[model samples]
Target: MWKCLERVLCLNCAFAFAIILARTGASPVIVNGALGYSVSLSPLTSVSQGIDEVVWRRLSPRMKLARCSQGSVQYFNTNYTNRITLHYRNFSLEIHDLRKEDAAEYEVITATGNTGNEHSELFQLKVYGLVSGAHITVQGIFGICNLTLICTVTSGDPTFTWWRNGEALVNDSTQHIRVLGNMLEVHHAAEVKYAVYKCEASNPISKATAEIKLRDVCKLDTSDPLPNSSICAEFQATRSSAATGSF
Candidate 1:
């Protein structure tokens, strides 16, 4: 709870400063990165109060600074320049051909038009890499027509892709993935149709996918380890039997 509040406060403060800079006709900019995402940094108040100069810095493993007036300044690290592009008008920095090392915090500094009214705001940049190790399962039955779908990724990026019979499954209006960590949950599973299901992890450079085939309750081979089941002991049999009877 405290951590959440801290984040909110920090965001609000950054916004307030951006507002003050806009009102003063001060240069305000937002620095962030995106591969498939289109993000913009808007002056929180659109009123540049006293800010005269705006600067954006990339802070990850090392500090790379860029000036609003000058396109690029001397950077402590050399790797960022080739991958980073600056947009001074909106105070944004776009990272191209992202890499895993690009994940970290960034900064924005504003100098007020007056002699000594300067302040700085820091923003965080996270680079998501290619994801891997995905599995899918079905559970939670409501009726002959109701069920649930669950997709799990053991590691890698948070993004997930659900496929049925080797084709991408279209999520329904009522379907949503759980944002708690990286778990993907879909409610209201299909009633009778069963097929090969897959979850693919994606990032900038490559993708890895895991697949599982779902059979009917009558044809499902409970004789073998429930696909992807880690349980190797007879305990799996006992547990499966007990649960099957109850349901």
Candidate 2:
């Protein structure tokens, strides 16, 4: 809990400092990247006057990425060879085709020409991959008509959204629909008929989807007709346009 609070306080301080700079007409930028994408961490505005040199580093691990002094930019060690570049004028660092290992804290420090006072700003980069899978499964009550649909995945930090027949599925007070995390619970035979529940998972880079065709699972066989419930009729009439849905 203390670690969590520290992280929150650290982020809050970062944002507060950024806002202070923006208010003073010097707004630095934080860059977020994804796997296989290129990123550049540059200041949106110029640094303070009398600044003569700049240095960049991975602030947390204290790894030097680049240095800019006397109008020249220098890359550090071989760990960043061929994949990192530094801009001499502003000391911005360019990362080519980002990877998970590249995620870390970064900072740019400015050296004053005469005032002897140094200023610095921070930039933190986070890299993530596209969401994968979203495999859905039906659990229990194959004959009783009550069920739960579970959505799963293999990788990536993802946010999930639930859909029913292409419409957003929210909690229904009648106990017919219930959504929690990646699970969707259904009760009543009418709720099980003529519906399709879709689970969409997404990360910074891309989206993936999976679905449960209620008509297929609810009915015993393809030859069997749909239930004659009013709710089922309504769902059938409002068919979803998810013909090409894929995982």
Candidate 3:
């Protein structure tokens, strides 16, 4: 009898869960959030009326974030104790000061009555960090005047772009310009037409650029058969500092 009773209870729970899933018919909305920023998760379905109680939860490794009922709010997660706000009217949630770990699937459940029926909405939050502290380094081969410019960043995953004289730099075999990932190589440096080179590092949230003068870094006298290593060394020491600015 006990086993039969257990099976009946399991079936009841599954039926209740199916109803909740049916109410949350739409797929989770994608929401991009930046670190140390705020993001709002609003339900597509209107909850202005017939909402007795509202609960917000993180889906995976399930944990309650906040709850609202009878015009009063309660927070459950200690980490987000003072950082989350719940809207009583529409049953929406606003999270502040987002962290990397906050990137996850969230669900808002609304209860209308004692009929055991609940309406739920899901949202997928992706948190990204702002790009910053970008710099460039220059290196040259001993015999040839070929030079490679490398852009490095102190934080954030970013895409790198190379520019010349405020224009986008394109790869051309004839011009000896090659862009490889974060490194830009200039073969036969003297033959290159542009003087000022810029490397821009960017992400979804922000971007930064670092500029370099060709004459400043490549101070070698190309006319001479053998370039002076001492002069190159001196230039390397003085121009080692990268020129950086935010955009």
Best prediction by lDDT: 3
TM-score ranking of the models: 3, 2, 1
Clashes of 3: 0
At residue 208, candidate 2 shows an lDDT of 73
TM-score of each: 0.42, 0.66, 0.68
Ranking by lDDT: 3, 2, 1
lDDT of 1 by residue, 83-195 (tens): 55556555555555655566566666666565655555555554443344555555532233233455555544556566655556544423533322223344324453444
List model 2 lDDT by residue over 1-247, tens digit each: 9999999999989977865674344443545676766778885335446567787888667888888777777888576788888776556778887788888877777767786546667777877765675677766544456778777777667777788778888667346778887888877464354677788877655667786666534555435453432222211111111111111
> Each candidate: RMSD to true structure?
15.4, 11.4, 8.2
**Alpha carbon deviation, residue 239, candidate 3 (Å):** 20
- The reply for model 1, stretches above 4 Å from the true place, is 1-47, 59-62, 70-77, 130-156, 159-213, 216-247
